[model samples]
Target: MMTIGMIVMLIASVVMVLASFLSKKTTTDREKSSPFECGFDPMNSSRLPFSIRFFMIAIIFLIFDVEIALILPMVMTMKSSNLMIWTSTSLFFIFILLAGLYHEWNQGALNWSA
Candidate 1:
Protein backbone atom coordinates (compact mmCIF):
# COMPACT_ATOMS: atom_id res chain seq x y z
CA MET A 1 0.00 0.00 0.00
CA MET A 2 2.80 2.44 0.83
CA THR A 3 4.62 1.63 -2.42
CA ILE A 4 1.47 2.24 -4.42
CA GLY A 5 0.90 5.59 -2.66
CA MET A 6 4.49 6.63 -3.35
CA ILE A 7 4.20 5.65 -7.02
CA VAL A 8 1.00 7.73 -7.36
CA MET A 9 2.67 10.74 -5.72
CA LEU A 10 5.71 10.45 -8.00
CA ILE A 11 3.50 10.26 -11.08
CA ALA A 12 1.49 13.34 -10.00
CA SER A 13 4.65 15.38 -9.36
CA VAL A 14 6.15 14.42 -12.73
CA VAL A 15 2.90 15.30 -14.54
CA MET A 16 2.66 18.74 -12.84
CA VAL A 17 6.29 19.63 -13.60
CA LEU A 18 5.91 18.46 -17.25
CA ALA A 19 2.72 20.51 -17.63
CA SER A 20 4.47 23.71 -16.39
CA PHE A 21 7.44 23.27 -18.76
CA LEU A 22 5.20 22.40 -21.72
CA SER A 23 3.06 25.55 -21.13
CA LYS A 24 6.07 27.94 -21.32
CA LYS A 25 7.32 29.19 -24.69
CA THR A 26 11.02 29.60 -25.61
CA THR A 27 10.31 32.82 -27.53
CA THR A 28 11.73 36.08 -26.07
CA ASP A 29 10.38 39.57 -26.87
CA ARG A 30 12.42 42.61 -25.78
CA GLU A 31 9.46 45.04 -25.74
CA LYS A 32 7.39 42.67 -23.63
CA SER A 33 10.21 42.16 -21.10
CA SER A 34 11.07 45.87 -20.80
CA PRO A 35 9.16 47.90 -18.21
CA PHE A 36 6.28 50.06 -19.47
CA GLU A 37 6.14 53.81 -18.82
CA CYS A 38 2.70 54.93 -20.01
CA GLY A 39 3.41 53.51 -23.50
CA PHE A 40 6.38 55.90 -23.80
CA ASP A 41 10.06 55.00 -24.24
CA PRO A 42 12.06 55.41 -21.01
CA MET A 43 14.52 58.32 -21.32
CA ASN A 44 16.07 58.03 -17.84
CA SER A 45 17.29 55.20 -15.66
CA SER A 46 14.54 53.45 -13.67
CA ARG A 47 16.43 53.48 -10.39
CA LEU A 48 16.01 56.67 -8.35
CA PRO A 49 17.35 57.75 -4.96
CA PHE A 50 14.75 57.52 -2.19
CA SER A 51 14.59 59.95 0.76
CA ILE A 52 16.08 58.35 3.89
CA ARG A 53 13.94 60.49 6.21
CA PHE A 54 10.76 59.42 4.39
CA PHE A 55 11.82 55.78 4.54
CA MET A 56 12.63 56.00 8.26
CA ILE A 57 9.30 57.69 9.06
CA ALA A 58 7.43 55.06 7.02
CA ILE A 59 9.22 52.26 8.93
CA ILE A 60 8.41 53.90 12.29
CA PHE A 61 4.73 54.25 11.33
CA LEU A 62 4.58 50.59 10.27
CA ILE A 63 6.22 49.48 13.53
CA PHE A 64 3.68 51.42 15.62
CA ASP A 65 0.81 50.22 13.41
CA VAL A 66 1.79 46.58 13.87
CA GLU A 67 2.23 47.13 17.63
CA ILE A 68 -1.34 48.48 17.81
CA ALA A 69 -2.61 45.47 15.83
CA LEU A 70 -0.84 43.08 18.24
CA ILE A 71 -2.12 45.01 21.28
CA LEU A 72 -5.74 44.72 20.12
CA PRO A 73 -5.66 40.91 20.45
CA MET A 74 -4.09 41.26 23.93
CA VAL A 75 -7.12 43.34 24.93
CA MET A 76 -9.46 40.56 23.82
CA THR A 77 -7.36 37.93 25.66
CA MET A 78 -7.00 40.04 28.83
CA LYS A 79 -9.91 38.33 30.66
CA SER A 80 -8.20 34.95 30.31
CA SER A 81 -4.70 36.20 31.22
CA ASN A 82 -3.28 36.79 34.70
CA LEU A 83 -3.72 40.51 35.47
CA MET A 84 -0.30 41.19 37.01
CA ILE A 85 1.63 39.27 34.38
CA TRP A 86 -0.35 40.80 31.54
CA THR A 87 0.14 44.34 32.81
CA SER A 88 3.88 43.86 33.28
CA THR A 89 4.28 42.25 29.85
CA SER A 90 2.29 45.04 28.18
CA LEU A 91 4.28 47.76 29.96
CA PHE A 92 7.59 46.15 29.04
CA PHE A 93 6.61 45.90 25.36
CA ILE A 94 5.55 49.56 25.29
CA PHE A 95 8.72 50.60 27.08
CA ILE A 96 10.82 48.78 24.50
CA LEU A 97 8.92 50.47 21.70
CA LEU A 98 9.42 53.91 23.30
CA ALA A 99 13.12 53.19 23.76
CA GLY A 100 13.48 52.36 20.09
CA LEU A 101 11.67 55.59 19.19
CA TYR A 102 13.97 57.56 21.45
CA HIS A 103 17.02 55.94 19.87
CA GLU A 104 15.78 56.84 16.41
CA TRP A 105 15.10 60.41 17.50
CA ASN A 106 18.60 60.71 18.95
CA GLN A 107 20.06 59.44 15.65
CA GLY A 108 18.25 62.28 13.81
CA ALA A 109 16.63 59.83 11.37
CA LEU A 110 13.31 61.51 12.20
CA ASN A 111 14.49 64.84 10.78
CA TRP A 112 13.25 65.69 7.29
CA SER A 113 15.81 68.35 6.28
CA ALA A 114 19.56 67.99 6.07
Candidate 2:
Protein backbone atom coordinates (compact mmCIF):
# COMPACT_ATOMS: atom_id res chain seq x y z
CA MET A 1 0.00 0.00 0.00
CA MET A 2 2.85 2.39 0.90
CA THR A 3 4.71 1.58 -2.36
CA ILE A 4 1.52 2.22 -4.40
CA GLY A 5 1.04 5.60 -2.61
CA MET A 6 4.65 6.62 -3.40
CA ILE A 7 4.21 5.64 -7.09
CA VAL A 8 1.01 7.65 -7.32
CA MET A 9 2.69 10.70 -5.75
CA LEU A 10 5.64 10.45 -8.20
CA ILE A 11 3.30 10.18 -11.19
CA ALA A 12 1.18 13.13 -9.95
CA SER A 13 4.31 15.29 -9.49
CA VAL A 14 5.60 14.55 -13.04
CA VAL A 15 2.14 15.23 -14.59
CA MET A 16 1.82 18.53 -12.70
CA VAL A 17 5.28 19.67 -13.84
CA LEU A 18 4.55 18.78 -17.48
CA ALA A 19 1.12 20.46 -17.32
CA SER A 20 2.63 23.67 -15.87
CA PHE A 21 5.29 23.87 -18.62
CA LEU A 22 2.73 23.18 -21.39
CA SER A 23 0.20 25.72 -20.02
CA LYS A 24 2.65 28.68 -19.92
CA LYS A 25 2.19 31.38 -22.62
CA THR A 26 5.03 31.49 -25.20
CA THR A 27 3.98 34.96 -26.50
CA THR A 28 2.17 37.80 -24.71
CA ASP A 29 -0.32 40.09 -26.51
CA ARG A 30 -0.38 43.80 -25.50
CA GLU A 31 -4.20 43.85 -25.18
CA LYS A 32 -4.31 40.57 -23.25
CA SER A 33 -1.50 41.64 -20.89
CA SER A 34 -3.30 44.89 -19.95
CA PRO A 35 -6.03 44.84 -17.30
CA PHE A 36 -9.61 45.31 -18.53
CA GLU A 37 -11.63 47.96 -16.66
CA CYS A 38 -14.94 48.54 -18.41
CA GLY A 39 -13.28 50.54 -21.29
CA PHE A 40 -11.32 52.65 -18.74
CA ASP A 41 -7.56 53.06 -19.28
CA PRO A 42 -5.61 50.47 -17.26
CA MET A 43 -2.46 52.64 -16.98
CA ASN A 44 -4.29 55.49 -15.25
CA SER A 45 -4.44 55.89 -11.41
CA SER A 46 -6.81 53.23 -9.96
CA ARG A 47 -7.88 55.51 -7.06
CA LEU A 48 -10.97 56.84 -8.79
CA PRO A 49 -13.60 58.74 -6.79
CA PHE A 50 -16.39 56.47 -5.50
CA SER A 51 -20.00 57.42 -4.72
CA ILE A 52 -20.84 57.63 -0.96
CA ARG A 53 -24.48 56.78 -1.66
CA PHE A 54 -23.47 53.56 -3.45
CA PHE A 55 -21.21 52.59 -0.56
CA MET A 56 -24.00 53.22 1.94
CA ILE A 57 -26.42 51.13 -0.09
CA ALA A 58 -23.86 48.29 -0.25
CA ILE A 59 -23.42 48.40 3.55
CA ILE A 60 -27.20 48.31 4.02
CA PHE A 61 -27.43 45.29 1.70
CA LEU A 62 -24.66 43.45 3.63
CA ILE A 63 -26.36 44.18 6.97
CA PHE A 64 -29.70 42.83 5.71
CA ASP A 65 -27.93 39.81 4.20
CA VAL A 66 -26.35 38.94 7.57
CA GLU A 67 -29.71 39.48 9.32
CA ILE A 68 -31.33 37.05 6.87
CA ALA A 69 -28.64 34.45 7.67
CA LEU A 70 -29.41 34.85 11.39
CA ILE A 71 -33.18 34.58 10.80
CA LEU A 72 -32.91 31.35 8.73
CA PRO A 73 -31.51 29.37 11.70
CA MET A 74 -34.37 30.60 13.89
CA VAL A 75 -36.83 29.16 11.36
CA MET A 76 -35.11 25.77 11.51
CA THR A 77 -35.18 25.77 15.32
CA MET A 78 -38.88 26.81 15.53
CA LYS A 79 -40.17 23.20 15.27
CA SER A 80 -38.35 22.09 18.45
CA SER A 81 -38.66 25.31 20.50
CA ASN A 82 -41.53 26.61 22.62
CA LEU A 83 -44.14 28.31 20.39
CA MET A 84 -44.70 31.45 22.54
CA ILE A 85 -40.99 32.10 23.08
CA TRP A 86 -40.08 31.46 19.46
CA THR A 87 -42.90 33.69 18.16
CA SER A 88 -41.89 36.58 20.43
CA THR A 89 -38.20 36.23 19.58
CA SER A 90 -38.87 36.16 15.84
CA LEU A 91 -41.24 39.14 16.09
CA PHE A 92 -38.68 41.13 18.09
CA PHE A 93 -35.96 40.41 15.55
CA ILE A 94 -38.23 41.33 12.61
CA PHE A 95 -39.35 44.50 14.39
CA ILE A 96 -35.72 45.55 14.90
CA LEU A 97 -34.96 45.00 11.20
CA LEU A 98 -38.03 46.99 10.15
CA ALA A 99 -37.16 49.80 12.58
CA GLY A 100 -33.63 50.01 11.14
CA LEU A 101 -35.01 50.11 7.57
CA TYR A 102 -37.47 52.84 8.58
CA HIS A 103 -34.66 54.82 10.20
CA GLU A 104 -32.53 54.55 7.08
CA TRP A 105 -35.52 55.59 4.92
CA ASN A 106 -36.22 58.60 7.15
CA GLN A 107 -32.54 59.63 7.03
CA GLY A 108 -32.61 59.47 3.20
CA ALA A 109 -29.88 56.80 3.18
CA LEU A 110 -32.13 54.53 1.11
CA ASN A 111 -33.01 57.27 -1.40
CA TRP A 112 -31.31 56.89 -4.79
CA SER A 113 -32.07 60.40 -6.05
CA ALA A 114 -30.18 63.43 -4.76
Candidate 3:
Protein backbone atom coordinates (compact mmCIF):
# COMPACT_ATOMS: atom_id res chain seq x y z
CA MET A 1 0.00 0.00 0.00
CA MET A 2 2.84 2.40 0.94
CA THR A 3 4.73 1.58 -2.24
CA ILE A 4 1.63 2.23 -4.35
CA GLY A 5 1.13 5.62 -2.64
CA MET A 6 4.78 6.55 -3.27
CA ILE A 7 4.45 5.63 -6.96
CA VAL A 8 1.25 7.75 -7.28
CA MET A 9 3.01 10.73 -5.67
CA LEU A 10 5.99 10.36 -8.05
CA ILE A 11 3.69 10.22 -11.09
CA ALA A 12 1.70 13.27 -9.87
CA SER A 13 4.90 15.31 -9.30
CA VAL A 14 6.26 14.49 -12.79
CA VAL A 15 2.92 15.34 -14.45
CA MET A 16 2.65 18.68 -12.53
CA VAL A 17 6.21 19.68 -13.52
CA LEU A 18 5.59 18.89 -17.18
CA ALA A 19 2.22 20.68 -17.15
CA SER A 20 3.73 23.81 -15.56
CA PHE A 21 6.52 23.98 -18.18
CA LEU A 22 4.10 23.39 -21.09
CA SER A 23 1.59 25.99 -19.79
CA LYS A 24 4.25 28.70 -19.12
CA LYS A 25 3.79 31.83 -21.29
CA THR A 26 6.74 32.61 -23.58
CA THR A 27 6.07 36.39 -23.50
CA THR A 28 4.21 38.71 -21.16
CA ASP A 29 2.06 41.52 -22.60
CA ARG A 30 1.72 44.83 -20.65
CA GLU A 31 -1.96 45.24 -21.55
CA LYS A 32 -2.85 41.69 -20.49
CA SER A 33 -0.85 41.93 -17.24
CA SER A 34 -2.55 45.14 -15.97
CA PRO A 35 -6.08 45.30 -14.57
CA PHE A 36 -8.82 46.22 -17.11
CA GLU A 37 -11.30 49.00 -16.19
CA CYS A 38 -13.68 49.93 -19.02
CA GLY A 39 -10.68 50.24 -21.47
CA PHE A 40 -8.99 52.71 -19.09
CA ASP A 41 -5.22 52.43 -18.53
CA PRO A 42 -4.47 50.89 -15.12
CA MET A 43 -0.79 51.85 -15.25
CA ASN A 44 -1.62 55.24 -13.70
CA SER A 45 -1.40 55.89 -9.92
CA SER A 46 -3.76 53.47 -8.09
CA ARG A 47 -4.43 55.98 -5.26
CA LEU A 48 -7.36 57.56 -7.09
CA PRO A 49 -10.19 59.27 -5.20
CA PHE A 50 -13.05 56.97 -4.24
CA SER A 51 -16.72 58.05 -4.16
CA ILE A 52 -18.09 58.39 -0.59
CA ARG A 53 -21.65 57.71 -1.78
CA PHE A 54 -20.58 54.43 -3.39
CA PHE A 55 -18.81 53.41 -0.17
CA MET A 56 -21.87 54.25 1.95
CA ILE A 57 -24.15 52.27 -0.38
CA ALA A 58 -21.75 49.29 -0.17
CA ILE A 59 -21.80 49.46 3.65
CA ILE A 60 -25.61 49.60 3.70
CA PHE A 61 -25.78 46.54 1.40
CA LEU A 62 -23.40 44.61 3.67
CA ILE A 63 -25.41 45.46 6.78
CA PHE A 64 -28.70 44.26 5.21
CA ASP A 65 -26.95 41.11 3.93
CA VAL A 66 -25.85 40.27 7.47
CA GLU A 67 -29.33 41.00 8.83
CA ILE A 68 -30.89 38.66 6.25
CA ALA A 69 -28.44 35.94 7.27
CA LEU A 70 -29.49 36.38 10.90
CA ILE A 71 -33.20 36.39 10.01
CA LEU A 72 -33.06 33.14 7.98
CA PRO A 73 -32.13 31.05 11.02
CA MET A 74 -35.10 32.48 12.90
CA VAL A 75 -37.43 30.85 10.38
CA MET A 76 -35.98 27.38 11.11
CA THR A 77 -36.03 28.01 14.87
CA MET A 78 -39.73 29.00 14.73
CA LYS A 79 -40.79 25.35 14.99
CA SER A 80 -39.00 24.91 18.34
CA SER A 81 -39.41 28.37 19.90
CA ASN A 82 -42.42 29.72 21.80
CA LEU A 83 -44.92 31.39 19.47
CA MET A 84 -45.40 34.57 21.54
CA ILE A 85 -41.65 35.12 22.10
CA TRP A 86 -40.81 34.29 18.48
CA THR A 87 -43.48 36.68 17.16
CA SER A 88 -42.26 39.55 19.37
CA THR A 89 -38.60 38.94 18.51
CA SER A 90 -39.25 38.69 14.77
CA LEU A 91 -41.44 41.81 14.83
CA PHE A 92 -38.81 43.71 16.83
CA PHE A 93 -36.03 42.70 14.45
CA ILE A 94 -38.09 43.71 11.42
CA PHE A 95 -39.01 46.99 13.13
CA ILE A 96 -35.34 47.76 13.72
CA LEU A 97 -34.56 47.01 10.07
CA LEU A 98 -37.37 49.31 8.90
CA ALA A 99 -36.25 52.04 11.29
CA GLY A 100 -32.68 51.85 9.97
CA LEU A 101 -33.94 51.99 6.36
CA TYR A 102 -36.10 55.00 7.22
CA HIS A 103 -33.13 56.74 8.89
CA GLU A 104 -30.92 56.19 5.82
CA TRP A 105 -33.73 57.33 3.52
CA ASN A 106 -34.28 60.51 5.52
CA GLN A 107 -30.53 61.19 5.56
CA GLY A 108 -30.53 60.90 1.71
CA ALA A 109 -28.07 57.98 1.72
CA LEU A 110 -30.52 55.96 -0.38
CA ASN A 111 -30.94 58.76 -2.93
CA TRP A 112 -28.92 58.13 -6.11
CA SER A 113 -29.59 61.58 -7.56
CA ALA A 114 -28.54 64.89 -5.93
Candidate 4:
Protein backbone atom coordinates (compact mmCIF):
# COMPACT_ATOMS: atom_id res chain seq x y z
CA MET A 1 0.00 0.00 0.00
CA MET A 2 1.49 3.29 -1.13
CA THR A 3 1.00 6.42 0.91
CA ILE A 4 -0.77 9.50 -0.58
CA GLY A 5 2.61 11.19 -1.02
CA MET A 6 3.90 8.15 -2.94
CA ILE A 7 0.80 8.16 -5.18
CA VAL A 8 1.33 11.86 -5.97
CA MET A 9 4.98 11.18 -6.72
CA LEU A 10 4.01 8.37 -9.12
CA ILE A 11 1.61 10.64 -11.01
CA ALA A 12 4.25 13.41 -11.22
CA SER A 13 6.79 10.90 -12.49
CA VAL A 14 4.38 9.67 -15.18
CA VAL A 15 3.68 13.24 -16.28
CA MET A 16 7.42 13.99 -16.41
CA VAL A 17 7.99 10.84 -18.51
CA LEU A 18 5.28 11.88 -21.00
CA ALA A 19 6.72 15.41 -21.20
CA SER A 20 10.20 14.03 -21.95
CA PHE A 21 8.78 11.67 -24.58
CA LEU A 22 7.06 14.59 -26.29
CA SER A 23 10.20 16.79 -26.13
CA LYS A 24 12.70 14.31 -27.57
CA LYS A 25 13.06 14.03 -31.36
CA THR A 26 15.84 12.88 -33.68
CA THR A 27 16.89 15.50 -36.27
CA THR A 28 19.62 16.06 -38.82
CA ASP A 29 21.20 18.89 -40.90
CA ARG A 30 22.35 22.48 -40.36
CA GLU A 31 19.02 23.89 -39.08
CA LYS A 32 19.02 21.28 -36.31
CA SER A 33 22.70 21.76 -35.41
CA SER A 34 24.06 25.26 -35.58
CA PRO A 35 25.72 27.26 -32.77
CA PHE A 36 22.98 28.76 -30.62
CA GLU A 37 24.48 31.42 -28.36
CA CYS A 38 22.55 34.64 -27.67
CA GLY A 39 21.14 34.22 -31.22
CA PHE A 40 24.57 35.35 -32.50
CA ASP A 41 26.99 33.42 -34.75
CA PRO A 42 30.33 32.33 -33.34
CA MET A 43 33.33 34.37 -34.56
CA ASN A 44 36.17 31.88 -34.09
CA SER A 45 36.79 28.60 -35.83
CA SER A 46 37.18 25.38 -33.78
CA ARG A 47 40.73 24.94 -35.15
CA LEU A 48 42.02 28.19 -33.63
CA PRO A 49 45.20 27.80 -31.60
CA PHE A 50 44.73 28.00 -27.85
CA SER A 51 47.19 29.76 -25.50
CA ILE A 52 50.40 27.85 -24.61
CA ARG A 53 49.88 28.98 -21.01
CA PHE A 54 46.87 26.66 -20.77
CA PHE A 55 49.01 23.66 -21.76
CA MET A 56 51.94 24.73 -19.58
CA ILE A 57 49.80 25.10 -16.46
CA ALA A 58 48.08 21.81 -17.23
CA ILE A 59 51.46 19.98 -17.49
CA ILE A 60 52.73 21.58 -14.29
CA PHE A 61 49.50 20.62 -12.50
CA LEU A 62 49.88 17.02 -13.73
CA ILE A 63 53.53 16.79 -12.58
CA PHE A 64 53.04 18.15 -9.04
CA ASP A 65 49.62 16.52 -8.52
CA VAL A 66 50.98 13.00 -9.24
CA GLU A 67 53.08 12.91 -6.02
CA ILE A 68 49.85 12.45 -4.03
CA ALA A 69 49.29 9.13 -5.82
CA LEU A 70 52.91 8.06 -5.08
CA ILE A 71 52.60 8.88 -1.37
CA LEU A 72 49.04 7.57 -0.80
CA PRO A 73 49.80 3.81 -0.83
CA MET A 74 52.63 4.13 1.66
CA VAL A 75 50.46 6.30 3.93
CA MET A 76 47.53 3.86 3.85
CA THR A 77 49.53 0.61 4.27
CA MET A 78 52.04 2.00 6.80
CA LYS A 79 54.33 -0.85 5.73
CA SER A 80 57.67 -0.04 7.29
CA SER A 81 60.08 -2.26 9.22
CA ASN A 82 63.34 -1.05 7.77
CA LEU A 83 63.78 2.73 7.69
CA MET A 84 65.98 2.49 4.62
CA ILE A 85 63.12 1.52 2.32
CA TRP A 86 60.99 4.52 3.31
CA THR A 87 63.98 6.87 3.42
CA SER A 88 65.21 5.80 0.00
CA THR A 89 61.70 6.01 -1.52
CA SER A 90 61.17 9.52 -0.12
CA LEU A 91 64.61 10.73 -1.24
CA PHE A 92 64.09 9.16 -4.68
CA PHE A 93 60.79 10.92 -5.11
CA ILE A 94 62.30 14.28 -4.06
CA PHE A 95 65.31 13.74 -6.29
CA ILE A 96 63.19 13.13 -9.38
CA LEU A 97 60.95 16.10 -8.59
CA LEU A 98 63.92 18.43 -8.12
CA ALA A 99 65.62 17.11 -11.24
CA GLY A 100 62.56 17.82 -13.33
CA LEU A 101 62.31 21.27 -11.78
CA TYR A 102 65.94 21.96 -12.53
CA HIS A 103 65.56 20.82 -16.12
CA GLU A 104 62.54 23.05 -16.58
CA TRP A 105 64.39 25.95 -14.98
CA ASN A 106 67.40 25.49 -17.26
CA GLN A 107 65.23 25.12 -20.36
CA GLY A 108 63.37 28.30 -19.40
CA ALA A 109 60.09 26.41 -19.25
CA LEU A 110 59.37 28.12 -15.92
CA ASN A 111 59.78 31.59 -17.42
CA TRP A 112 56.80 33.73 -18.42
CA SER A 113 56.59 34.67 -22.14
CA ALA A 114 59.51 32.38 -22.98
Clashing pairs in 1: none
Screening candidate 4 with a backbone cut-off below 3 angstroms (N, C-alpha, C), the clashing residue pairs are none
Question: Distance (Å) between predicted and true CA of 7, model 1?
Answer: 13
**Which run of 10 residues does model 1 get worst, by summed lDDT?**
39-48
Residue pairs clashing, model 3: none
Best by lDDT: 2
Cα error, candidate 4, residue 19 (Å) = 16
| lDDT head-to-head 2 vs 3, winner | 2
Task: Give the TM-score (vs. native) of candidate 4.
Answer: 0.57
C-alpha local distance difference test of each model: 0.90, 0.93, 0.92, 0.76
Q: lDDT by residue for model 4 over 4-93, one digit each (tens)?
A: 889999999999999999998776667557676665555555475787766766787798889768877766555654568777877798
Residue pairs with clashing backbones, model 2 = none
Order of models, best TM-score first? 2, 1, 3, 4
Model 3: per-residue Cα lDDT over 1-114, one tens digit each: 999999999999999999999999999998898888885668777788998778878998999999999999999999999999999999999999999989988888788786
Q: Model 2 residue 93 lDDT?
A: 95
Assess candidate 2 and give its TM-score to the true structure: 0.67
**lDDT of candidate 2 over 44-112, digit per residue (tens):** 999989987788889999999999999999999999999999999999999999999999888888886
Comparing 1 and 4 on TM-score, the stronger one: 1
Q: What lDDT score goes with residue 89 in model 4?
A: 74
Q: Per-residue CA lDDT of candidate 1, range 5-100, in tens?
A: 999999999999999999997998887777789955576787879988889999999999999999899899899999999999999989999999
